[model samples]
Target chain A: MRTLVGNHGWATIAAPGNTGNVADFLVCRLIGSIFICFSAILSGCHAPLSANNSSRVEITYWRTLTGAAGEGQEELVRRFNNSQNEIHVHCEFQGSYSDLAAKLFTAAAAGAGPDVTQLGTFEILQFARAGLLVDLKPYFAGPEAINTKDWPGTISTAGEVEDGLYWLPFNVTVPVLYYNEDAFNAAGLLGPPTTWDDFYLYARKLTVRDDNGVVREAGVALWNITWPLISAIWSEGGKLTTRDYGHITLDDPVVLKVMTEFQTLVREGAALLPDEASGGHRAAFKNGRAAMILDSPAAFQEIFAQAIGFTPMVAAYPAGKNGKVYAPGGGGLVLWAKNPATNRAAAWRFLRFMLSAESLAYYSQQTGYAAFTESAQQVMTNDLKDSRFGVIHDGLRFVRGDFSINMSPSVRNAFDEAFQKIMVDLADVKTTLMEADAKAEHAIAERGI
Target chain B: MTRTSLKACGIRRRPRCIASQWRSNRSEWLTFGAFVAPNLVLFVTFTYWPIVYSLHLSFLEWDLIEPSAVWAGLGNYARILNNPQVWRVASNTLIYAASVVIVAQFLAFFLALLLNLKLRGQTIFRTLAFTPYIATTAAAALVWVLLLDSKLGPFSFIFARLGVEGPQWLARSGLALVAIILVGIWREIAFATVFFVAGLQGLPPECYEAAALDGATRRTMLWRLTVPLMSPVIFFLNVSGFIAAIKMFDIVAIMTKGGPVYPASSTYVYHLYKLAFRDFEAGAASAFAVLFLMVILVATIAQFRAGQKWVHYE
Candidate 1:
């Protein structure tokens, strides 16, 4: 039998009196193969660079849009890539606004994240305060700088915090009223309601009941979110909070009055409050179960595309007592402050491309978000003339985001809970609002807001 | 003579005995170490390290975006305890957990007994019962949402036919929690049924034969022999079911998002997630996590201690 023996550091099969040449050969070959494999892996790990693009700066951009909007964003990046070979941007679609914010925060804490990301209006102040955002004002001074005069004043200044412009408007949207024209014609309404009283009366008229008294079609479907409701509250001469968020006034008498009217509509079976599981109010309107809905223009494409057998029309939100004061809704671009100087410059260049008139117009037309720039509106002149698109853009001039208390998640949660209790549970409006105010104050103090 | 006597008497032979033992068991010890090393390393890295770090974080205030944290000590715990929402959320969690566990186990045990009977299409029944446990929870939840719609759902059609308005299962606060509990029971019954069936099949026939020979009734045999023999499975199902129900997050996240009002149907993990991610309060979330861990630990220990009375080892 052959015995195994150790010589120096090698194990070998030892014959009676022979040197283990085969074992040595096998061991040497194994080590050689491992070395070659490791070398190949290391060499293959380098980023693929083409001959002409060796000097191009690579940067990452995280956006929070999907479907047609996502495709529009991708097309813009593609055009920018083809326009010049100086930079290459890798655009990634992060999930919804809240999801993106959560990931961005954790990533920023680790000193690593995308070079640029889309930020919601509510998140701008928080991020800027935390020093995670780069001030865009510094980048707005060069030859390629954006001309703020062309952008709507409210949209342009929405990201201003502590005198620094940390976010640049990209996909801006304003809430608009979508009504089923067929239902409106059947209800014998001459035109869209111009006042809240007309809106209430119109809802009652449009509501269709069967012989059994079950509502076959609701008159209006209220979106169960707080965004569109903000416009209603503001139009009624009610403020959610002060400009500085020093005090929350959700319990204001005017706010209660507006909410009570809404509650009355629901109680009267003229309005539908569809839950998210039921496809929200949008689906209710699309399926001919509801005649009208208040939603952002961002929902226009999908609503029109899916509202079969009904002529979905766009109209301005019904004016409240103080006339319409709309709240701007949508997201903007924010550069990460921790990016290297070279990457930051490349990211800014990409962001500038994204905000160009041509790109903005293309995105707005594709996604139903309003083109916030004059040049972009000029680009879409024909489209803007259409009644459906015209009504959506009309609210741009009246948009306001001064009520920033909704920026606090705590306060927002309180408002949402209070709204749900009033609408769904039919709780006492005054008591619920009072409780929400107390909750918001407690949260504000606890968070040192 | 003295040295030899001492060595043979086990006084001076202790070192040699240990050496011999080590030498003989060296390969066995190495094999055991090799087998356990990977799991140990993984547990330390993913579980232990995070738990220890969370404990450290609970003592400090951090928003998770800032570079440094402020020392808050027990302030987070104190604030969490004082927050009324915490009590509301805790009550919701307790209600959900207790309802899911007791109802699910009761139904699952009966299902297991029914399925264990020698009926036609037994294989098909088993597969049907187990399908929900294997379905992707998020996808299943979305489908459930559509099925529970107040106006357009099948239930609404059925209710309309009966001349009654369908209850808004997911819109009303109280009914929303009930709907969640029903879904939890539906999902959990599959898991518990499969285990119970297996345990039933594994039970010894000798005990039942002995019971019959002793002139015991079928009911007596079932209650005494079968149940006693199946106590371990029952114990396991209750313990695991309670833990899973308490930690439920995905269903609530997809179905209601703790809605219709704050803390209406929120569970512990869902509330903890909102605190950490939504509110950006890492310290308070960590404190919440620590408290949650303690509650789960105490509950599990209590279950185990009570189980010792009835759980039989074969």
Candidate 2:
């Protein structure tokens, strides 16, 4: 089974063949090929024992990052491989996040998915429901585990399914406010908005109309704006999903109020809804066409490179009247196999290697991603001093990615749609959200994980 | 009897000729069966059986995870009817299909006619026009994404300079379908142009000469003579283009992922994909697929009926 798990599904040997008479020259070549090859072979009857079986056990790991992050994961695996001869781990780049999930679900259905694949914190519930994941509760409960106290509470929350630990939070993120310093200075504004009311006030203050009354320079425009609205709703004490993760909670007035206020902002010309029909949110920001946009800390690199004539400053989201805040976030988490007799041993071994302090530092340093372990994080704390890192954890404080992996894409789609409708004036706040809520509930009820 | 039986009465024979006719009939049956056996087997194995299986499976509810599908009767179809997204998907499919067919086919026809003319570097011109068609949709959409990309894309950059704020091409709902339509047209134009060119080449030369003798202008000749002559081929192209456009998946999949909204830029096939893979609604997807097949069937029938008056082989 371990050998099977480590095969990586390469099946090139199964070529269909027909045995026919060989040409005379080919037969001579074949005979010659055998003798020539044999000359270089060591004259040992038994296979040379390079390393004994007991020296190391191999585990196959599937991850979904490419380029630098991919290389980081690869380096981590290499370090793990080199650390000791007791365990050899291989890392395979499955695909991007959505692509990985699709491939995973498809393969699990086909009974050929990998043994210790990386899963999102929220996806654990869905996979667990489908019996696609091996339960990690027993692994953590067993004597061979480290203390869970070092892990952040919020980061670990999404990884649990019905009080059972499912996966580790890998790269969690929250939507920090990224504003143009030059734009703010030009508008004669003091600083980033620290409250929702202040956000509206600054957006109004930031608006500059030309002589002809057509505004040449506008205030803050939200890019990738849906998650921020969700954050606002959460700050107002609303949830996007229920505690059980069975149905969506979009119809709640707190959520609707957030959407309605956003609509009013569009009406007042504080924010420009970039024509989604054209492309998406990032385009609006990168062109220096907008003063401010809300995006993830992971986006710090891209925004810095893309934005021109302006330095983007990262800030915490506005604190609502309730002193509440929300985070727009998620992370890839590791999970162990349930089959303790076979994959569990391999999974635990692999997990330990992957989450090692030195390994995590190498991974974090390479990708600019946060580590799941406190020890791993401590090693890279000096490098985390950028202004962008300050508001991120607070932004991720209320980040929710739980939608029962089965209903997530669909439910999130509904929420995204509702947000679009709100911005585009196609559907108003109350009706659109209600419609979305109904659709999301129907999707959830109809398609259980 | 049916129309064939009535036509058979046109043959005249005596009673004694009946025995000889029976012997001929037996030979004809053997030869006909032998000739059709291979095709019949293929049709049954590939086309008919799968269709039957799809129909059977459509009435059952199951995700890909399940070992066997559980029967759901009309439940899947009922759910689709109730869901607002399904209606949106159907409408979107119609808009996408109709727009692609009309726009692509018109452009193809005109371009093909132009290419058919005896011109300098006609092969080069044809190749230049056709390169986009042979290119994979994924590659084409990617290039289009970069070109039309609102942020760093060149098309958007140019568009900005022109004072036209181009929306995010693949992200927003208002113009997503149009973006998809544009990509679909680009992907299809080459094939249409090639097919149209073939149709033009196959035209009888005498009609044009006759028109010339009658002092018909080139425009008049094209409208009165060439266009009518190419009706049969045009009809075939239209039907095929219509079908292909209706079933378009690759362009939509690569370009939009049927997003920003549920019904805004979605199509039936895209809906089917979501239902089956994303939502784990295989039974509903299959049922929707059946409805989609019905649509195509009806369209084909309508096309055949409409073709009789307009499609002139001569």
Candidate 3:
């Protein structure tokens, strides 16, 4: 007989020993199912703890590397895991660099941050100042420390902050000229320009126009943003700031000359500034809308990946009156300050393994960033001598880090505002720069070291 | 004699029946509690706890990197009040919210009226109008970015074809805000339209019939009979729309990134984001959040107070 159990929706069958066999069979099946489910759940609950007891420490490493660069990092981690049995490093892709910064902030705030994270050169300073980063001095002094002298000076010294070394250099890239070979050929330009004057002339020549005087295709995409303008300033023997990074020097005559030259391209309808909301300047070159663009070496893989009917070409940044002086741009691995002693030791081991010559060489081949160590250079030569990445390696000799002070971000924002005023709003260049300089100075003072 | 004996037996059973009923209710309540406990726990943990914690954090100065927090009485609040950039951001937020509410609501109401006309394929038009409302804001904003791109964008390209050089939509300073407002209106109008349509459908037909009998024109009938009845819906939409506009983030983040830096298109939330995430000024960010909550509360209260003047339930 079926009996209702209280006012709840549950019911039970209270069958006697003499009841039908069908009811007994049903009851037996229900009990068997419940037993199986309970056993499965109990086993699942204990599985992880058992696994954890036997294994070495597993540390989380967050890096903001995507596409080919992400794959390279994954490969590096795989190699590291295979090389030893003591520590297993689980690497996670953390979106764009900006996204990585935001997530890292939240994660660190919650005290559940990754053991190691890749940080941009500028971010290294920001984090180090906030005391978020662990000083790698102890690691550098320890037995696992790689020979610092063997690494490229441009990349190795970029992550240095005061007396503390907070980052180990990984992928290194510099802005170089990426040109559409098909567009260059169609414009009857045999090779890339070597100087600023030729650069503009080639830009004009490469420009295609419709009957209505509308530019059907731009000659080049020259934006007024930090990197392109900085490259131009460096080429013109001008610096964005003083050597000590204590003052703004954007109003320098050499810098003004480069600024005027770029603005003139926009004015003459030969070059167009890609809207930052839309895909950046790189997008224009990729879509065949422009013949040339100034882009970072890190973009080489993406450019090749997106190339449809034509192979793109890379050239060293054009020289100015002084010479070629391109700024290196890429991120490096930085350890979070909070970690247990054993995890710290394992993290240092993982970091050292990832920063080796073989790893850098492998990473360089997978992504197009230049190998930034002497030993990696030998490995890359043996591995990728005739590859498309040769241009990146050639561009490396000219590269160095930008002026990155503690307040670099604020200073950069100030300059960027002035840049928009001059380029997008068509304001007077010198006046805007002067005003922006005051703002930058004010910001630096307000945000004081 | 038999009927009186039966009545006596019924009286004897009544107390036992009542006891059984009480026991049944207790078990039902326990079952209900068991079912709701999981969701209630989650809601309190994730939602209620964060709000309370943030309120607490508002009074403390701590960067996430620092191991501990220091109590800062009114320091964060004072800084927010004194900073001129905060004022500019407030102005931007006000302008954005006002424009979106006014433009989007009016457009949605008009579209609702149009769709209300007894016409062919009304459902299709209604569906098309509501599509953007259901579409993810981030994805739509990304598409809008491409459409309004200054150079080589189809919108600019089409304008050029018509012999007009389109203004740099997002590249220029103030113009970027305008583009964002346009996109906000585009995304939100469908929501307003759906509500307006529902209100329109629920309206009493006798009022319109009486006005028509009195030889009232379409415009007059609409203003006199329809609008007064629709006031409650309009009021509901306005209050909620104002809140949504004030809280807008995805579009601004995706489209402008608070840029053209000279005339930065930073909203209040965007400013707070830069403070907390970019600068690691958690205390200041929390303070801003508290202030924003107060602002929203005041605005909502004021809206409700003002609604008494015009909102007609009938």
Candidate topping TM-score: 1
| Model 3: per-residue Cα lDDT over A5-58, one tens digit each | 324332333334323343334445555665687689878843432224366778
Name the TM-score of candidate 1.
0.91
**Which one wins on lDDT?**
1
Give the per-residue lDDT digits (tens) of candidate 3, residues B1-314.
47578788774334457667667455444445545655676799899998898888889877656677889999889989998879988988899999989999999999999999899999999999999999999999999988887666788877787876667777667688888889989987989999999899999988889889999999998898888999999999999999999998888888887776533687888888878877668889999999999999999999999999999997
Candidate 1 CAPRI level? acceptable
Docking class of 3: acceptable
Off by more than 4 A, model 2: A1-56, A207-218, A223-225, A245-249, A273-279, A334-341, A393-413, A441-449, B1-56, B66-69, B143-172, B210-220
Error at A149, model 3, angstroms: 2.6
For each candidate, the DockQ is 0.37, 0.13, 0.28
Segments of candidate 3 deviating more than 4 angstroms: A1-55, A186-188, A242-245, A308-311, A382-384, A401-407, B1-49, B52-61, B67-75, B78-84, B150-153
Model 3 chain B is weakest, by summed lDDT over 10 consecutive residues, at B26-35
| Residue pair clashes in candidate 1 | none
lDDT tens readout by residue for model 1, A1-449: 14334553434334433343534444456556656876887676544434456788888888887888888888988999899988988888889888998898888877767888888876777788888999888788876788878777477777888789898878888888899999999989878898888988999999999878888899999887778888888888898886566888989998898889889999988997887776888999999999999888888889989997989998998888889888888888999986676688888888988999999889988889988888999999999988787887788888884537556776787898889889988899999999988888887887745
Compared with the true structure, the alpha-carbon lDDT of candidate 2 equals 0.69
How much lDDT does each candidate structure score?
0.84, 0.69, 0.79
**Span of ten consecutive residues with least summed lDDT in model 1 chain A:** A11-20
